[model samples]
Target chain A: MLLCGLTLLHALVSGSVPIPFATVLQLLGGQAADPAAGQLQTIILQLRLPRALAAMVTGGLLAMAGAYMQVLLRNPLADPYVLGVSGGAAIGALLALMLGLGSSLVSGGALFGALASMLLVFGLSHRHNNWYSEQLLLTGIVVATGWGALISFILAISPDQQLRGMLFWLMGDMSHSDTPTLEAMLLLVCVIISLPLATRLNLYAQGPMRAASLGVAVQPLQWTIFVIASIMTATAVQLAGAIGFIGLVIPHIMRRVVGADHRILIPASALGGAILLLLADTLARTVFTPMQLPTGVLTAMLGVPLFLYLLNKGRRT
Target chain B: MTVLSCQQLQLNVPGKTLVSGLDWDIEAGQFWLVIGRNGSGKTTLLQTLAGLRPAAGGEISLHSQPLQQYRRRQIAQRMAILFQHQESGFPITVQESALAGRHPHRGLWDWSDQDQHETVFSALQTMDLASVMQLPVDQLSGGERRRLELATLLIQDPELYLLDEPTNHLDLHHQISTLEHFSGLAAAPQHCVVMASHELNLGLRYCSHVLLLYGNGAWEAGRIDEVIDPERLERLYQHPMTVQPGSHGNIYLPA
Candidate 1:
């Protein structure tokens, strides 16, 4: 947690404008006295800080959502995208763009799309008191495939003028996300709701039958976790574009550090995810300065190899 | 006092009846061994009594109230079940897994406190799992995993225990030790233990009450001494069987 705060500070000070640490601190502390430093402070305060905060919130939400998804589905591979949630969100945003909708409306479209896919998967997987994980996974996989086809169709038909921006958004860019208050609030609410259910979530991961035997309200708990994860994924997709890998890998990594108790794992995953995405977003901004990359691209590029290495190492152990 | 009771309970699938028209009562300080051939619905009956599955047709009450009427946590506070199989989605240490048994007693926002830790610690020690407390369940041997399961049940400290194939993966020594532990629990006042098993000898030795599930929606329940008829045992399994009056208890063997 301390490391995440320090990294956030470094991110604020080391952006393109390179505002001095002292000026950044003064601005943060509401004590900037020099008029000459006002523009640099505005750039840091207005542009960089909010961007960093948004990335952290989005990343934290994604990781927590992924963790709970793994528990509810009882599948280690399950994530926010495993159920076509991100795909649905992307399709909604893309459809909005295809209609020349404004950016704000596009976010709403993404949230709507996410909820629709979530409901579809939930409704399809239901079968006479049996919410089998395999059935849910199969439903999610098919729905994701459907969303994938629609997203591709939309991309293929979109005008050339909007292609670059659309592609960047799909790849997940934090540059265009200006505000963080709503996402931050949502993130806070999610964390609070999730923390109380962590123990039940852990038991549920063993299986619905076992969870019920242990006295967990298995159906209600599964549904609650599912909705929360879907909402978090939708919020993340809205705040950033469609950042991946972090959601899937952050929980795995936190499990190694904090063990499998969800009480500790949830908070650890939240902080670890925030730090990871903030770092990835920073690299995305500064690595090729004149031409920034989408944050999701960098996360995947970095995450896949790291995840494989960890998995391989775990096997060896 | 009667802890659990069922009336006209019918457990069936789409076109098959496993057990039906059953009326049974379980009082405190009694151990019931559900014995039957494979596909005889022993597990189903146990699960139904645990409230994991609704009976096909019947009513069950826990302490004079409808079983379904009790909240899940309320049921958990009074009953704990050990499943036949368990899986983990993440790497969880044996100790951590056992600690999950405390969930029924905990408030949503409450973390395990000192007393809960002591309870888990003693359970681990009792099951001889203290040596591997930090090891993940996946890494443990089959016998170790079974013992871990027992350890988890021990910590739950429920008034009623429903175990499905509790002796599954245990060795001869562990089989006896685990059964002895359960016998001790069942001997205590206001406590009960129920298990589904194919091990007729073990059931004969330890169980005070016996329920025979005969696959075609037919069944019988009684005190073990009154129900251990060699002819009925032969009919239950569709084979001849020998009943030896051993020093400890009767032993059933195929004749």
Candidate 2:
């Protein structure tokens, strides 16, 4: 969390028009003494601060969701998008863009799409007196595949003028980072609600039947995890346009450090994911000087090798 | 008092019946061994009794209440089931896994209390897992994993235990000790044990009652002395068998 705070501060000051550390601190403390530094103050407080905070929260949300899904499904490859919420969101966002809608409308459509997907998975997986975990898993995978096809179809038919922006969103750009309040609230709420279920989630990692035998109320618990993870993923996708790698890799990395106790691993994953994405976003902003790469690209570039290194190191020991 | 009772319980697959019209009563302090050939629905019968599977046709009552009336957690507090094997791709320490058994007694989100910790500790010690409490369960051998699974059952401390193949992958000594421990648990007036095992002699030695499942949906449940014999054993397995009166119990062997 300390590193996350520091990274947020560094991101706030290291933008195109760099603000000195002292001025940044003064502005943060509600005292911008010099009238000459008005632009710097505006940039730091209004623009950079919200964007940086949004990046951190989005990263934390995605990682936490991924951790829950991995345990809930008992699959290491499970991620925030495993249930097709992201694919649904992407389809909605892309549809909005093809119709030349505003960014807010696009995000709203994305959230709507995600909700539809969640309901679809939930409804199809539930049958008369039988809520098998495998049924849910298979349903989610098929729904995600369906949404992926729709997203591709949208991309192919979109007009040239809107294609660049759509592609940036697809690759996960934070340049148009939405307001952070809703995302921040969701991040806090998800963490608070999931903290209690963390221990139960640990049992679930063994298998659903094992968890059921251990008194976990496995069906209800699995449903709760699916909803929480879906909400987190939807909120993050709406804010930052489907960032990757943090969700898939951060929980695995944190498991090695925190030893797979969901209580510690979930929170640690939140913080670690926040730091990682904050650093990646900052690097994305500054690496090419005047131009910027999509933050998702940088996350994968940085994450894949680091994750592989950790896995290899674990195997050696 | 009768702890578990099923009337006309029938277990079946899609096109065939495994066991039918089976009526049985399990009282407190009774240990029952359910024996059958492979594919004869021993696991299915145990699962149905544990409320893990639906019975084809019958009413199963726990503590005289309809089984479906109790919530999953309520049922868990009353009974624990040990599967033949547990597989996890994730890593969890032995102690942590054993402590998961306290879930029925602890509130949701609450950590294990001191009494719960002591229970898990003793369970670990009983299974000889005390020396490797901190080791990841994935690192344990097959026998060790089986013992650890038994430790989890011990930690659950439920009124009834439904164990299927409890002694699978265990060494001879561990198997004997584990069954003896189960019999000791079943000696209490308010507790009972129902195990499905292929080891006819061991079941004969430890269990007071037997439920032999013949392949053609036929079954007999009674005191071990009355229910198990050379004739029934041979009929159940569809093979010739020899029975000997051993010092401990009847020895069943294929002739």
Candidate 3:
């Protein structure tokens, strides 16, 4: 939490136009009054503050969704996008961009696409009143592949004028996010709701039969995790446009630090994810100065090496 | 008192009928060993009895109530099952794994209290795993994993235990001591055990009753002595059986 606060303050103070730490604090404290400080206030409050919160919320959401997905599929390699949710969202957002839809409508389209993909995977994998994890993984991967094909097809036919905007969204840009409040509320609600199921989730990670034997309603719990994770991934994609590595890597990192107890792992993953993304976004915007890099690129570049190192270290130990 | 009862129970795998028209009553203070050749539906019957799988035909009742009518948690609180195969997908401490046994008794948002911790600790000690409670389950040996499974089952402390190949992967000492522990548990009032096993000698020594599956929908259930003999054992295995008289009892061996 201290790290989160420090990261947030750093993000607020450092930007293309560096605002002094005192003025940033003054603006945050609701005391910026001078004409010069007004512009600084706008820069801090309107631009950097919302972006920081969005990064935090988006990061936290993706990480929690990843944690749930890993358990729900019983695969350590499972991530939020493994189910093709982002592919679906990408298709929807790209289509909205192609048709010149408003930004809000693009988000709505992305959400609709995500839901469609979720239902597709759910329907395909559910049979004989059983939702087998292997079946779900296979079906999700196939559907994601199909969505990927569609995404490429859409990109090939899109107009050149809107191509840059579409590409930025695809690479996960945060500059367009105007509403972090909804995403923040979602992150809060997900953490609140998921904590109660932490113990059950621990049993669930063992296997479905054992989990059932241990008193978990395995079927219902599986469905609940799937739905909650899909919504989280959808909202994160809607807010930040397919930021990738936070969801996949943050949970594993947190698991190493806090062990596999969901009671601790879940909250720790959320906080860790928030901090990592906040730092990543700060670097994404300020490192390049006037020319902003896509936040997802920075996450992947940083996350890949860290993940590989962890994997190698794990094998050694 | 009957702890679990099944009427005309049937179990089947895709192309084979394993057991059919089986009526069995597991009374309190009885240790019943399910004996059969491979694919004879011992595990299937145990799973069906535990309500882990649906019976092809018949009714399973726990304490005079229909098993289907009970909620999963309620059923879990009354009955526990240990599978032959155990795998941990994630790294977890032995203590955490054993603590999962308390899940059935705990409510949502209820934390494990001191009593549960003590219970888990004792179960770990009984399984000879107290020293390695902090070790990740994946790092444990096959025998240690089996013991961990037993410890978890011990912590569950249900009225009925349905264990499929409970002694698999266990060392000789652990196998004997674990069976002895289950025998003791079954000796207590309001507790019963049904375990599927391949060890006929151990079954004879520890089990009060025997359930023989013939792998073709035929079965015999009665007191161990009444249902087990050289001739029946030979027929059960479809091979010649030699019985060596030991000080404790007859040890049956394939000939």
Candidate 4:
């Protein structure tokens, strides 16, 4: 939480204009009486504040979804995108860009695409009220591959002029995000719904038969996790256009720090994810002064080394 | 009182019918040993009885109600199963793993309180795992893991225990002590146990009843003394058996 606060402050203060810490503090405290407060308020409140909140909520959503996905699939390498959500969202966003749709429409397209992919996976894998984890995972992988092929085909014929915007959306760009009230609400709801299931999820992480023997309704719990994770991944892709590493790595890092009890791990992963993305987004916007790099690129560059170092350190200890 | 009863219970795996038209009633304070050769439906029968799998045909009742009528939580409150294989997919402490047994007893928002912690600690101590309660489960040895699983089942504190090979990975001492513990548990007024095992001597020593699965949809169930003999054992195993009287009981050996 302290890290989240610090990152939020840094994101509000560091930009092209370089607003002073005191001024940022004052603007946040509703004291805008200073003579030069007008422009600073616009920069902090209008521009950076929304982007920072977007990053925070998007990060929390993705990380929580990723944690649940790992348990649901019983695989450490599972991520939010492992189920083809990002692939579907990427196709939607790229198609919107090709059609010269407005930014709002692009987000809408991505959300639609994500939901469609979720339904497809759920439908294909579910049979006779029983879906094995392996069967679901295999179905998702094959569908993701199909979506990957479609994505490549779409990129093949698009005109050169709109290619950059399409690429930005595919790689993840948060510059177009407005105030994140909806996504923030979504993150809160997901956290609330998931916290109650944390204890049950611990038993679930053991195996299905064990969990069932221990009093968990394995089938219903599995279905709930699938739906909840799908919604969260869809929301995150809508907000940030498929930002990658936070969802995959943040849960693992938090697991090492807080242990595997989902009660603590879920909240810790959310905070860790929020901080990492806030820091990365701040760097992505400020490092080059005028030109901005894709947030996904920066997240990968930052997260890969951190994950590898932690994994090695864990092994040594 | 009848703790668990199955009428015309049937169990199958793919194209093979392992057990069929079976009727059995497990009364309170009765310890039943389900003995079968390899490829028989011992595991499948136990799983079906525990509501972990659907029976091919039959009705199972717990406390005079259909097994399917109760919620999973309700069922868990009355019964617990110790599976044959234990796998931990993620890192968890021994204490935490055992504490999961308390899941069905607590409400959704309730955390593990002091009483539950004490219970878990005692259970771990019983399993001789108190000193390493904080260690990760993946770091435990096979025998230690099996004991940990037993400790978890003790913490669950169910009335009906359906244990599949409760002595799979235990050492000789642990095997004897664990069976003794279950035997003691089955002597309680409202408690009963149904275990699957191949240890004829131990089963004869501890269990009051026997369930013999012949691996071809044929089975026999009765008091251990009446249901078990060299002739029945030979037919059950498809091999000649010699029975030797030991100090504790009769031991069956293949000839």
lDDT of 2 by residue, B100-182 (tens): 88888787657645667788889999998899998988899999999988998888888999999998999999999999999
- Docking category for candidate 4? high
Using lDDT as the measure, name the better of candidate 1 and candidate 2.
Answer: 1
Candidate 4: regions farther than 4 A off: none
Question: What overall lDDT goes with each candidate model?
Answer: 0.86, 0.86, 0.89, 0.90
Which residue ranges in model 2 land beyond 4 Å of their true spot? A118-153, B112-115
Per-residue C-alpha lDDT of model 4 across residues A88-156, encoded as one tens digit per residue: 898888899899999988998999999899888878888887766688788888888999999988989
RMSD of every candidate to native, in Å, equals: 1.7, 2.1, 1.4, 1.3
Q: Which pairs of residues have clashing backbones in candidate 4?
A: none
Docking class of 2: medium
lDDT of 1 by residue, A94-153 (tens): 888888899988888888988898888878998885678889999999999998898888
Q: What is the interface RMSD of each candidate, in Å?
A: 1.3, 1.4, 0.9, 0.8
Chain B TM-score, model 2, reads: 0.96
* lDDT score at residue B211, model 1, on the 0-100 scale: 93
Candidates in order, TM-scores: namely: 0.96, 0.95, 0.98, 0.98
Evaluate model 2: give its lDDT: 0.86
Could you give candidate 4's per-residue lDDT for residues B1-255 as a string of tens digits? 999999998888999999999999999999999999997999898888889999999999999899999999999999989888876579888888889888889999888557798899998888889999989888999999999999998999999999889888889999998999999999999999999998888989999999999999999999998988899999999999988889888999999
Question: Which of 1 and 2 is ahead in DockQ?
Answer: 1
Clash totals for all candidate models: 0, 0, 0, 0
